[model samples]
Structure formats: C-alpha cells, structure tokens
Target chain A: MKLTILGCHSATPRINTHPTSQVLEIRNHIFLIDCGEGTQVQLRKNKVKFNRIKHIFISHLHGDHCFGLVGLISTFRLLTREADLHIYAPKGLKEVITMQMKLSDSWTNYKLIFHELTSRESELIFEDDKVEVYTIPLDHRIYTNGFLFKEKENERKLLLGNAEEAKINKAYFRKLKQGFDVINEEGELIKNDTVTKAGSAPKSYAFCSDTAYNESIVPIISNVDVLYHESTFLEKLSHLADKTKHATAKQAATIAKKANVKKLVLGHFSTRYDNITEFINEASEVFENVEVAEAGKTFEF
Target chain B: MKLTILGCHSATPRINTHPTSQVLEIRNHIFLIDCGEGTQVQLRKNKVKFNRIKHIFISHLHGDHCFGLVGLISTFRLLTREADLHIYAPKGLKEVITMQMKLSDSWTNYKLIFHELTSRESELIFEDDKVEVYTIPLDHRIYTNGFLFKEKENERKLLLGNAEEAKINKAYFRKLKQGFDVINEEGELIKNDTVTKAGSAPKSYAFCSDTAYNESIVPIISNVDVLYHESTFLEKLSHLADKTKHATAKQAATIAKKANVKKLVLGHFSTRYDNITEFINEASEVFENVEVAEAGKTFEF
Candidate 1:
C-alpha cells in the first residue's frame, strides 16, 4: 500500500502550505481522502492521475476538509470524464454539492453517486474482494468519521513438489490452495497443511484527523500497519487543542501507542508554527515509530 | 486605476494556468472579480493584502468563475476579519453560499452582505463619491454582466496658481474644484473652465468576459480607457466560439475597435493552444493597441 500526502496543514490554505488532502493507493484503488480547497491543483502538482480517483472519502464537512469536492466534480465534467464517481462523506455534503450543480446548471456526464455516512459506530462502508473499508467514529465539534482500509488475506500458496508427490490431480489443486484436504486419484485423503503454506499477513491502514484525543477508537484501529492522525498542536498548546477539539502531538502519539499501530504518521499541523520538528520530537516521546506528514511526501507500507 | 490579472485562462485550472479571476483597484477600493478556485493562493503569490478587499463581483455562477468565493469567505472568518464584505452576483448565489456555511456550521464574524442581481439591462451596481460601477449586460449561455468602472472626473484638479491669479478666496476653492463658477470679491463672475481643465479625461475601465461577440455592449463601454474582453479562442476556432457562446480573438478586437477604446486587453484563452502569440497578433490586426492578460501581470490605466 502507498499513501501520498498532497496537503497536511490545517485551517486555511496559504502560499506554501495547504489544508488537509491525501491520496491513498491500495489494492488497485486510488482513493482520494479529504479534498480541501486547492486540492485539484495539488493533485496536478503531485502528478496524480485525475482519472484514477473513483472513490473519495471525506472525514467531515468543514471547509478545509471538503470545499474542493464540488470543484473537482465540475472539473471532471469539463474534462469529459465518464467513469462513475463515488463520494463517502457526512450527510450534509450531498445537499451542498447537488445545490451547487443545480445552480450552475452543470451536471457531470458521469454517474455521480453519494454515500452519505451518518452512523456513529464502526461499520463497513466499502468492500470488495481485495479490500474492506470501515468507519472509525471520531469526536469533534461536528460529526466526523475516520476511515480504516484493510486488505483481505490472499489465497494460500501451492507447493508444486508436495502436490506432485501426493499425486494430487489438477482439479484438486484449487481445493489445496483454499486450505482444504482433497481425495487423490487413489481414493486416499490428503491433508491440506502438508501441501500448502499460509499466505502473507493482511495489512491495514487507519486515517484519523480533526478529532480530540479519544481512546475509544483504539480497539477499532488496533494492530494496524500504519496510522495517520492529526496533530494540530504541540504539547505546549494542549489547552488550545482542548478548546478546539483538536489533537496535540503527544495526544496523537498516545492514541497510536494505545492502538499498538506499527507506525504513526502525524499531520494537520497548525500554520502558526514556522517549524514542525517539535511535533515529531514530542510524538517520539510516547511512540518510537513516528514520522511527520510532509506535503508531497509519499509513504509505502 | 490598476488591474491585476490573478488568473485568466478559460475552462478548468491546470498546473501553471488558472481559471478566471482578477483584482481591480479603483478609487482606493480593492475589488475582486470572478474568484475562481485557487484564487486565494494566487493572491498570496501576488502579495495582495487580503484584508483590503471589501467587495467581490461575480459575473456568473459557473464553477470557474466563482468557486473560490466560499473558501475566501471561510478564510476571512479564520483570519478574524471584522469588516463587512459585499458580494454582487447572480440571484442564486446567496442560497448556495449560505447553505454551505450552514452545513459547516461556520459563519463569518464579519457581516457578509449579498446583492443579488437579476436585471437584463445595463444598470448602476455600485457608486461612491470618487468612483461609479455599472453593469454592462452581455450575451452568454447564462445570465452574465460585465462591469464598467469609471473614476468620477477626479474632482476637477484644483489649479492653485490659476485660482490665486483670479483672486478667488481660499474658501471658494472648493467651489472651483466642484466645477462651479464663483463670484469674485470684485462682484464679477469667473467661468470654472477658465481656471481648470478636465481632470485626466476621466479614465474608465470596462471588463467583459465569458460572452459571445455581441455588438450591443459597444454603446455601454464606448470610449473607455481600457477594455478587458474574453477571447476564448483564435479566429481559426471562431466556429467553436459561436457554438460555445464565447468570443474569438478577432471578435474581441472588433468590439474594441467599434467601442473606440484606448487599450484592448484580451484574456480567458482556451488551454488547447499552447502559444498565445497568435491571439495578440490576430487582435492587433484590427485594434492598434492590444495586450494579453497573463497571470501575475498587472495593467495600469
């Protein structure tokens, strides 16, 4: 799985810094996450293919999180994109985007679908044969959800020499790969473990942002391969974070440590600070594997 | 009057070229015109003071023309702007913007006033003591208006030397500047034109965009100092212009020549043609003085 940070700063877009937006490529899906203002330009700057973005996941309806969505939709129409697009966001987003389209009298030639999310509990929002996505309910000033993308386990590998030694026919090879014992041509039952080994472990990634320090999400995101969380402030500004319902670097690190995630990526830094090294330094105090999410940087897991 | 082209390309924004947006400074007022997406970043790149803008004029409701408005409004709130903001746009813009604010639960601390325009004829939209703004109705796919900004005769520059030579009292100098003939202390009337000449010829600027080649606007924008007109295509694609309700470079030059404007500024070129020198060459063939609107380029009249 690969994740690209198109933008990570919080609140407002500035000359060199942008608001929250990212692109995640996993299992043949290029998913856009949290399209803030100027996201389309950021996507162009990052060299991400616009046509590859079929599914968009918005964490909330804040301007900095979802303002670029309507523009992206309109640009798609101008570009003559014909693929169906899906948006999974808060319930109010459908009304906002549809209203803009209606006012402009411009609608996409493609099938624009909206999956309005309102459930406050962890539920499967998207799934396919290769991947599954679930919502991680978050605490914020408004209703929000963090998405958890998990890759499904692959089929067990086949041991050619062991299968041939067992005299297993070609038809029985499929059952062996499925971890099932099958009768050979001689009517003798074969054990599945003797012929095939287990597949690689499934990997998962969790995205959390614009939320206060909440431990309830730990169980849902436990043991994920990577966790990207918002660290809007440093420990020195924890009081401001409390008031704004945002997370401090230390608070995000605490959540990562509690969830036992393999790696922690901190993002959504407030624009007030000229330097962000302190975020990593503060997060490292709680979790050893921590990295700051830099704009245009890509992470592979 | 100073005009800054923040962005002038047509259709959607790209890596280097942006959609339609500009800043016009007239009579101590900074007016934002047609704020497309990424305009705030463009303003920052151009080093424009965000707080100085008090009014915004949107020609139409197309995404490329006005998508950046809500983001700018939200940014103003984030920056804690306290001054009132006025937006002059088509009838449906208020509902669209207000609904987005309502959905995000983020309203501006500053008063956001909307002046919805629905008239089909040319009408005065804004006026102050030193400046007057009137809408020039244009033919487009949707309801659209071009703005004509005229400096109100500049208070007829006070010819101190002439006034003193005429033995005009200091208190009566105001009357002379107001173009009023005054009675001298000797009980003789002095003509106003004898002391003062016309102030700078009363410079006027007209902005016409996203419209087809229509001759009706000639009378409204006649004899203006500068005319900024949209030339979405070259003469080679004049057929496309007719079909899309846009103007060609040659057609824009025709309008400039017929209107008898001093300078013609052609902009909103389609991204298809990489080299824009042809647009200037084609326009200058009909109009003597022509300039192409470029991003980050400023024009003074």
Candidate 2:
C-alpha cells in the first residue's frame, strides 16, 4: 500500500501551503480523501493520474475539506470521461456540487454516483473480495466521518514439495490452498497444515481529521497498521485546539498510544506554525513510531 | 491603470498554467475579474492585498471562469474580514454560492452582495466618482459579459504657473481645476484652457474573455486605452475555436483593429501550443500594437 499527501496544511490555501487532500492507493484502488481547494493542481504536481481516482471520500462539509469537489467534477467532464465516479461524503455535499453544475449548465456525460453518509455509528460502507471499508464516526463541529480501509485475509499458500510427498493429487491443490484437508488417490486423508503454510498478515489503515480528541474512535481504529490523525495545533495551544474542535499533537499522540497503532502519521497542520518538526517532537514524547505528512510526500508500507 | 495577470490560460488549471483570473487596479480600487480555481493562491503569489479587493466581476458561470469564488469567500471569513464584498456575475451564480456557504454554515462576518446580471445589452454595472464599469455583451456558449473599466474624466489639471500668471486667486484655483473660467482678484476673467489642459485623457481598459469573435462588443469597448481579449486558439485551430465559442488570436486582433483600441492584450491561451509567441505573431498580422498576457506579468497603461 502507498499513500501520497497532496496537501496537508489546514484552514486556507496559501502561496506555498495547500489545504487537506491525499491519495491512498491500496489493492489496485486509488481513493482520494478530503479534496481541498487547488487539489486538481496538486494532483497534477504529484503526477497522479486523474482518471485513476474512481472513488473520493470526504470527511466533512467544511470548505477546507471539500471545496475542490466541483472543480474536479468539471474537469472530468472536460476530459470526456466515461467511467462512473463515486463520491462518499456528508449528506449536504451532493446539493452543493449539483447546484454548481446546474448553474454552469455542465451536466457530466459520465455517471456521478454520490454515497451520502449520515450514519453516526461505525458501520461497513464498502466491501469487495480483497478489501473492506468502514466508517469511523468522529466528533467535529459538523457531521464528519473518517474511513478505515482493511485488506481481506489472504488464502493460505500451498507447500508444493510437501503436498507431492504426501501423494496429494494435483486436483486437490485448490483445496489445500483453501486450508482444507482432502483424500488423496490412495484414499488417505492428509492434514491441511502439513501441505500448506500460513499466508502473510493483512494490512489496515485509518484516516481521521478535523475532529477533537475523542477516545470513542480509539476502539474503531485499534491496532491498525497505519493511522493518520489530524494535529492542527501544538501542545501549547491545547485550549485553542479544544475550542475549535481540533486535536493537538500531544492529543493525537495520546490517541495513537491508546489505539496501539503500528505507526502514527500526523497531518492537517495549521499554517501558523512554521516549524513542522515541532509536531514530531511533541508526538514522539508519547508515541515512539510517528511520522509527519508533508505535501507531495509518499509513504509505502 | 495597472493590470496584473494572475492567470491567463484556458481550460483546466495545470502545474505551470492557470485558468482565467486577473486583478485590475484603477484609481484606488483593486477589482478581481474572473476568479478561476486556485485564484486565491495566485493572488497571494502576486502579492495582492486581500483587503483591498472589494469587488469581483465574473464573466460567466463556467468552472474555469469562476470556480474559486466560494473558496475565496470562505478564506475571507477565516481572515475575519468586515468589509462588504460585491460580486457581479450571471444570474444563477448567487444560488450556487449561497448553497455552498449554507452547507458549510460559514456565513461571512462581512456582507456579501450579489449583482446578478441578465442583460443582453451593454449596461453600466458599477460607478463611482473616479471610475465607471460597464458590461460589454459578448457571444459565447453561455451568457457572458466583458467588463469596461473607464477612469471617469479626471479633474482638469491645474497649471500652477499659468494660474499664477493669470492672477487667479487661491480660492479660484479649485474652480480652475474644474475647467471653469474664474474671475481673479484683479477683476479679470481667466480662461480655463489657458490654465489647464485635459487630464491624462482618462485612461480606459476593457477585459473581454471566454467569448467568440463577436463584433457586438466593439462599440462598447471602442477606443479603450488597453483591451485584453481572449485568444484561446491559434490560426490553425480556428475551426475548434468556433466550435468551442472561443476566439483565435487572429480573430481577436481583428476585433481590436476594428475597435481602434490603443493596445491589444491577448490572453486565455490554450495549453496545446508550447509557443505563446505564435499568438503575438498571428495577432500582429492584423493589428500592430498587440501584447501577450503571461501569468504574473503586469501591464501598466
């Protein structure tokens, strides 16, 4: 799995800083998250294929989180895209985008599917043979939700030499890979563990932003391989973070420690702080494994 | 009058190319025209003071022409702006903007006034003591209008030396600047022309963009000191220009030549051509005094 940070700055887009937007690539799916203003250009700067973004997940209705949706949809029309695009966002976002398109008289030629989310409980949103996605309800100034992406458990790997030594027929290889014991040509049952080995462990990721410090989400994202949490403020401004429904670096680190995530990624930084390294310094005081998200940076796991 | 081209490209915003947006500084006002996506960052890159822009003029509802407006307004709210912002755009734009702001629950502290336009004929949309802005109707795929910014006839210059020689009293100096024959202290009538000449000829500028080769606007923008016209295609792609309702360089120059504009500035370039100088070459074939608009380039007229 690879994750690219198109923009990590919060509040507003500045000359060198952009608002929140990221691209997560997992199991042949490229999911766009929180398309702030200037996201299209950020995607271009990051060399992300525009057509590859089939699904977009927005956290909330705040301008900083989802202002770029209309522009991206318009661009898709201009490019003559024919594939159906799916958007998973808060309930009100569909009206906002539809109004703009109606005003411009620019109805898209391709199908635009909107999955308006209104559930306040953690529930499964998408699932396929290889992956599953669930919503992590977050506490924010507005109705918001973070997404959890989890890879499905893989099938067991066949031990070819061991299977042959056991005199297992070639037709039984499929059952062996499925972790099942089968009768061989001599009508002798072989143990599944003797012919197959365990597969690699699956990976999971959770993204949470624009939310206050809430322990309720810790259980939903517990023990994920990677957790990206918003740290919009520093420890010194803990009061402001609480007042604004945002999390400070120390608070994010505390949540990471509570969830026992393998790695914690910090992002959605406020532009007031010039030194981003201070976030790492503060987060590391509680969580040993921490990383800061920067624009155009990529992390592979 | 100083005009800064924040972005001059057509279609989508790219890495190095931006969509249509510019700042026109005339007299004491800074007017934003056609705010495409990424315009707020472009304004920051151009060092334009956010507080000075009290008015924005949108040519049409096309995404490339006015998509950045909602984000800019949201940023203004974040900056705690208290000044009133006036927007002059097509009739449907107000609904589009209002819906987005409502969805985000971000009503600005400042007043947002919209002057929705549905006029098919040229009309005066804005005016003050120093400047008057009129709409120049154009032909495009949608309802679009160009803007004509005219510095109102300036107060006649006071020829101090000539006024003193004419024995005009200090109290009569104000009258002399208003182009009136004033009676001096010595009971002599001083001719206005003897003391003052025309004041800088009242510089005028017209911005015409996202329109086809329409001669209807020629009369409205005729004899303007500087004319910024859209040249979205070169001579080779004139057919496409007609189909898209955009103007080619040669076609734009034809309108400029017929209108008798002092200088013709070509902008809104199509990204297909690597060489923008070809626009100048094609336009120069029809008009002599032609300039090409480049992003971040400023023109003082």
| Interface RMSD over true interface Cα atoms for each candidate | 0.9, 0.9
Model 2 residue B210 lDDT score: 84
State the lDDT at B123 in candidate 2: 94
Task: List the candidate 1 regions with Cα displacement exceeding 4 Å.
Answer: A170-173, A184-187, B183-191
DockQ of each: 0.79, 0.83
- Candidate 2 structure lDDT: 0.93
What TM-score against the true fold does each predicted structure earn? Answer: 0.97, 0.98
Could you give candidate 2's per-residue lDDT for residues B101-128 as a string of tens digits?
Answer: 8877788999999999999989999999
lDDT of 2 by residue, A1-301 (tens): 8999999999899988889999999999999989999999999899899899999999998988998889999999999999999999989888878878887888999999999999999988888888889999999988999999999987899999999999999999988878899998889999999889998888899999989999999999999999999999998999999898999999999999999999999999999999999999999999999999999999888
Per-residue lDDT over A1-301 for candidate 1, one digit per residue giving the tens place of the 0 to 100 score: 9999999999888878989999999989999999999899999999999999999999998989998889999989988999999999999889888888887889889999999999999999999999999999999989999999999987799999999998999998888888899998899999999899998888899999989999999999999999999999998999999998999999999999999999999999999988898999999999999999988999999
Worst 10 residues of 1 chain B by lDDT: B194-203
> What DockQ would candidate 1 receive versus the native complex?
0.79
In model 1, what is the error at residue B55, expressed in angstroms?
Answer: 0.8
